[model samples]
Target: MSSDALAELSAQLPGDALLVGADAVEAYRRDRALDPTAGVPLAVALPRTTAEVQAVVRWAAAHGIPIVPRGAGTGLSGGASAVDGGIVLSTERMRDLRIDRTTRTATVQPGLLNAELKAAAAAEGLWYPPDPASYEICSIGGNIATNAGGLCCVKYGVTVDYVLGLEVVLADGRALRLGGPLIKDVAGLSLTKLFVGSEGTLGVITEITLRLLPAAPAPRIVAAWFASIEAAAAAIAEISTTIRPSLLEYMDRTCIDAVEDLLGRGLDRDAAALVLGGSDDLDPDGRDVAFMIDAFRRHGACEVAETGRAEGEALAAARRAAIPAVERRGRLLLSDVGVPLPRLGDLIAGVDAISRDREVTIAMLAHAGDGNTHPLVVFDPTDAVAAERAELAYGEIMSLAISLGGTISGEHGVGRMKRPWLREQIGDDALEIAERIKLALDPDGILNPGAIFEAR
Candidate 1:
């Protein structure tokens, strides 16, 4: 991009919204993945409002500069990776939010953090269900961009399910509001849904309308440790077949050890797998807790423990901390592959095989009931041989998931890192259709280039 054009665009946005120096822009180059091949952008634009965002997009479009829409930069995938000589359009300053209690919706800017939105909803006796592990740091806009899922999503649904409306600035700098607070409107194509998981390829989302539900009841927790991974997988499958718990999570011995190492918690390091089940049913006598306890014991649980509210939350907190805890082991290549409910055990077994074959340390964790797993590949950057193997194992895990009639990515979008295998999972015809739609919305190919699809 020409410096003249960037200077003009910089002048239009607020002083706090522009980062042009090399040092400042360096921090925006990559998200959680820390992609070594990420490029250096010409500038990073932090727009505080929709109009400022439109100004930056319009300027970038006129100059034919690619724009990467970024949120809190907490993405595990390289969805927010900067492009060479391009402009990074960050939503960090667009943190405005308003809660409409009567409509049961929250009108928010994309820059707001997921936890911030949840806390605001809670103050009004409402709830936002999609609680990604990084919810505390990840932005609501980033969550929607990736269609994020969490433990609660097994029963409450993913980010797309909560989204009601969006105000997006198209590639041509035209801002359009697709839907509203009225939930049942079948007015036209589901454009709002289209943007939820678009990964910023089509347009830059400035505002979103999210549906909220009444607060869930305090959960009763059930914890179980199994002797083998197969037994734990069988228990998860059986539990899914029976009742739908509010939260169902799994962590292998590797992950349990990592968390224990960091937190000094009394995690069962000898167990092959740990399963946690939570129920927020209205029944005061705790029928859901009783059911889960029975389910775990019947499915060969080595040990089962049921607890009241405080202990239950403590266990859930540990589960949520699994990612960061595991990160301390080494640099991580996290996989979010998912499979059919019946093939959940097969998928886990397949990953285990890959781990052993590649001779790499792979820590496994999952929202087990939903069949979504995060298999973290840990490797040292300085060890060339191990790094190469880790990279190969990363692709192999996705390949294994696809072979099992599953997705290469379940919650995370097919960002730059996973784009290579996207075509193999979704055939040419489906890819063609997606490209057509992307072209129609972003003919100039200025928004978040190299994300889901290649730049036109």
Candidate 2:
């Protein structure tokens, strides 16, 4: 990354598009994961259009400079972490969008935030279902990159489900359009879905075509508190087995107490776990609500109640706040491991065991209906002993998920932090095939180097 090389690259874009110097490029070095090993980038390219992104890609390719594609820098995994001598190609400036009411789709640039896209869809009386906790801050591009799952995903599906099309800038600077707004297009390979969770290893997504639906019915919420974590897990399993809950979430005592400390919410800190279930079905009989309440009671819920719409939203918001609330306690090594529905209870118990054995505080929460749990390992970063224990517990949790026929990452992509575990979970054969595909697409390995796959 010579100054002369950077100068040549800078000449290809708008004067303001290329950011240089340590101060200018500092913030683009890492995403929310704060990966300690993140490198200092040669520059940050803020591309505003597909042509500009192509230019950046071409420049990086020509100079043999790695390009780390970043979107809003809100990823929990270090997928957006910068590489040494590489350029951080950020899509923050490409914030254009259009809604096709008749087609029920939104064609949007990758820079738009998830919440912003949701709001834009709502303005047209359409709804975008995937709602990750960080929707307000996480970019839609990042969500697609990770195939993000959220509260509504259990019912409506993840980001990939809504992504009907993508305009991607390949490693060689060739811009390719993969799909369109049409619902049923089976004319070619499912390339659009492939890139949905590629995490920028294959190409840089410049634009996305998102499918939208008419707004869901206002959901009825059921809140249940149990004296035992197993009991809550059992309730979740039973409810999931029987009903398709629009939202099903779990929070353990550690998380509950942390949130209470942060928001002063009257959460039952003494309870072992809290389970929330919601149903948006238009049935007047409220069958889903009844089933959830029954499951909770049958599983020994100490308290169960149906919250009003406002109260329900508040509870859901509290669940969304769990990550930041737990973060307030100490540094976090977040794990998004998930197990099959039947193995959900075992996964939760296994994580509890790991926390105790490792002597670390692991605050657990989940989109329980789908069995995707976020076991947040909290530790004092300055305390070397505690940090080591936290790291051990993090790996153990992912291993536990793998042993129980679960994925190392349910929604978050296998970013650098989880890259080591990916091979073990997916097996060498699958990994090799994936690497072959990566090589086929990104032969030079310049796009988001050292992300899903290691740098060559």
Against the true structure, what is each candidate's TM-score? Answer: 0.98, 0.99
Candidate 2 weakest ten by summed lDDT: 1-10
Clashing pairs in 1: none
Instruction: Kindly list the per-residue Cα lDDT of model 1 for residues 1-456, writing each as its tens digit.
Output: 567877799789877778987999999999998877799999998888889989998898888989999999988889999999899988998899999999999999999999999999999999999999888999999999999998899999999998889999999999999888987988878888989888999899999999999999877788999999999999889888788889999999999998999888788899999999988887877776788888889889999998667877777888989989989989999889999889999989988998999999999999998999999999998999999999999999989889989998888878888899999999999999999999898888888888889866
Predictions in order: lDDT: 0.90, 0.92
Best-performing candidate as measured by lDDT: 2
Q: What lDDT, from 0 to 1, does candidate 1 have?
A: 0.90
**Candidate achieving the largest TM-score:** 2
RMSD value for candidate 1: 1.1
Listed per model in order, the count of residue pairs whose N, CA or C atoms clash below 3 Å is 0, 0
Superposed on all Cα atoms, the candidates' RMSDs to the truth, in angstroms, are 1.1, 0.8
Backbone clash tally for model 2? 0
